[model samples]
Target: MTEGTDRPRIIEYAGNGFVITWEPARCRHAAECVRGLPTVFDNTRRPWIVTDGATVDEVVTVVDRCPSYALGYRTADGRWRSAPAGA
Candidate 1:
């Protein structure tokens, strides 16, 4: 926990299109992230998500591939979004 145990910044975007959340830790190295959008979710990287690495559109495209709720997205104005069920 070198960066501090408080938790990495969990980005939850409730936008005109979707309500999405991401928990980078529970990701389980599925690589769904990096595979879907290499520019944003690179394996040979730190701060792996690199949300800034891609545009919000690109990020959402990749995040949608996550099998775990480690990444999630849905219609924004339809249902309220949440962070990792219990989290």
Candidate 2:
């Protein structure tokens, strides 16, 4: 959680081969993640982001399409691909 927000600024969902991080405040509702991989990014689900729903490669590909960079991933090897400056 950030300074004044009740919710976390970044939420993490981990799986076997990778870990996914989501920044709700940074999301622009473009739906690229949901459209690209519904099984993994289904907002209807309790946790919403389920990394086990898809493979590591699939998750990475879809997350990269995020226009606002609200979605990011960290590989098992500890490589992080997060948001850009000001995003």
Candidate 3:
């Protein structure tokens, strides 16, 4: 189950032009991220998230599918992005 009341653990992976953020405590492990973008969200990897594994557009699209808001992103330009409301 996800942490509903506590602050989540946030991890970041920076790539050439974007950064990916992961909130472990909030992850449901439903594999939406993995299914959507395996190359970047492979749990078998040490760090799990390889921001450079895919293009920025690919990363953003996959992250938007995260049902728990456990995944997020920021561009090199410093624009923060996240799954849409009610997602």
Candidate 4:
């Protein structure tokens, strides 16, 4: 765990083809991610945001919906991938 008042703590989860980055301090708990992808973003579960619970595309889609910008992702090669329109 990380602690700081000046910098947000970041947690990373790696999946088969992508990595998800989360910033808890930046999260507003808006539920956009939960609404978009329940299986992967379940707040009720420990270590929420199961990177492998869904496909890379699906994860990307939900992460993009995070209103607080707390969620983000990059491909295995370190290229950022944005969600498709309407995702």
Candidate 5:
């Protein structure tokens, strides 16, 4: 099911200030994202990324905190998500 298709899927790599994916293989786990944004990057939360943790706009800000591009974003219209400010 895609956006505007069936059911709305949960946003992945989403967080307050930014959204990102957990590329296990690519993830270096340098704790940069976590250190930068704890409220949104908590490990306890499943999927680990809460777009609603703050605001879609806010989440984009934090995801940029990630030194590595392991996390990403785009529009919610089935398009790949990207960080805000074009980070």
Candidate 6:
């Protein structure tokens, strides 16, 4: 959960060109992220979401396929895209 709130936890992982956010509570384990880009979404690794593993465009493409909207991203250019409510 988020600090001082009952909302499910949303973790952020930042890289040089983008920032990725993940809401575990919203994940359906669709595997879109892992299958689309294993280097970036490897659950076997600690702090699994590694934004730097791929380019901003590549990351955004995969994140857009997340069926549950558990994955989201913000680009360095100030464009924000995330869960429906968060977006």
Best by TM-score: 6
| C-alpha lDDT (0 to 100) for residue 39 of candidate 5 | 71
Residue 27 CA displacement from its true place in model 2, Å: 0.7
Expressed as tens digits, the lDDT of each residue in 1-87 for candidate 6 is 556666779999998789988999999998999999998999889978877658888888889999999988899988666777653
lDDT of 6: 0.86
Candidate 5 residue runs with Cα over 4 Å from true position: 1-19, 76-87
Q: Hey, what RMSD does candidate 6 come out at?
A: 3.5
Off by over 4 Å in 2: 1-8
Candidate 3 lDDT over 2-86, as tens digits, reads 7688544788888879989887877999999999989888889887887665988888888888888888999866667764565
Give me the overall lDDT of model 1: 0.61
- Which pairs clash in model 3? none
True-structure RMSD for candidate 4 = 6.4
Estimate TM-scores for all models.
Answer: 0.53, 0.82, 0.78, 0.78, 0.52, 0.85
> Model 2 over residues 1-87: C-alpha lDDT tens digits?
558655448988988889999998889988999999998888888888877758888988899999988899999876778977654
- Candidate 1, residue 47: CA error in Å? 1.7
Over 4 Å off in model 3, which ranges? 1-7, 77-79, 82-87
lDDT for each residue of candidate 4 in 1-87, tens digit (9 for 90 to 100) = 877676557788888899888888778999998898888788989988787668888887778778767788898665674334443
**Candidate 5 residue-wise lDDT, 1-87, digit = tens:** 556663323345543433455544445677776776777676677756555556555455655566655665654434444333533
As for lDDT, the candidate ahead, 1 or 2, is 2
Score each candidate by Cα lDDT: 0.61, 0.86, 0.82, 0.79, 0.55, 0.86
Name the better of 4 and 6 by lDDT. 6
lDDT of 6 at 63: 91
